[model samples]
Target: MSDQVQRDQTLDISQSFIVQAPAGSGKTELLTQRYLKLLSVSDEPENIMAMTFTNKAVDEMTQRVLSALKSSFKPKPKEPHKQITYELASQVMQRSDEKEWQLLQNPKRLKISTIDGLYSLINNRYPLPSQLVPRQIMAENWARDNAYRYATEQVLLMIDDKQQGRAIADLLLH
Candidate 1:
């Protein structure tokens, strides 16, 4: 890609763009740079949201941003990509210091999360009538157990039907 494209993606934060690329195309790096730039310009760290599809991606992105910020305190790295990250992180550190964001000390202020997490955050802030009760993400084991319970309930209900009950009995015997 041309430098202009790179600049547009990372430096031009005025407009949002959907980045679609193959694997290992430095999308995360570009996103981390853009996030740092956004942090420098944003009034509050929470105002800038970076969402990904999965929790793992969210964790990775958050770690990358935080790592970049921590790395800015060290000597400049030799790699070109690391140099870009260092420069952006340095700019963010300066802006953070001026604004008293305390990003390095309180990295949780950065709002990098999964899409589901964003929905949950929004729901927590402005819950719908149907969602009067707060919801929590179900753990894998809980989900599996709940699914089994639901399936058992459905099968028990089916047992009340004569034809289904006969089929179930035959299947069990077979």
Candidate 2:
């Protein structure tokens, strides 16, 4: 795709897009720009989520977005990519100022995290239905195995309860 078209698509927040490109191909830049655009138009900072595979990417993207917002307060950038970032950041900063978001003061409002982090956030916010314990996702296989074993033990213990046993049986039968 043409660069302009790709840029346009990235700025379009009305729909979602899966951006796939080789490393060092500005995918992060595009995503950061999109995130800034979303922030500019959104009232709730927590509603805007950007998920990546690794915590490293999450940190990088979060830093990039924050840096862009900070940089926007300075003079305009010379580089084309940075110029775009500055503009988007300026818009977001304007909206944030109007809404009194205080993003710079509280950057944690930005919902940029790894997929596992997002899952954990959801699990913590809305707990699982019954005696089923919510499992914390881990990157290491050993941790995952341990969590699974622990959850299984909890479920087994719950099986002794008549009501819980019936719920488990119903779930297993389905």
Worst 10 residues of 1 by lDDT: 132-141
| Cα lDDT, model 2, residue 3 | 75
Q: How do the residues 101-174 of candidate 2 rate in per-residue lDDT, one tens digit apiece?
A: 99999999999999899898987877678624444332365687989999988987887698799897777788
Evaluate all candidate structures by whole-model CA lDDT and list the values in order: 0.85, 0.89
Q: In model 2, which runs have C-alpha deviations exceeding 4 angstroms?
A: 131-174
lDDT of 1 by residue, 1-174 (tens): 895566556568888787777898888988998998888888888999999999999989999999999999999999987888899899989989999999978988999998899998887876678865445433555788999999988887797688799887676688
* Alpha carbon deviation, residue 86, candidate 1 (Å): 0.9
Clashes of each: 0, 0
Model 1 misplaced stretches (Cα beyond 4 Å): 1-4, 129-174
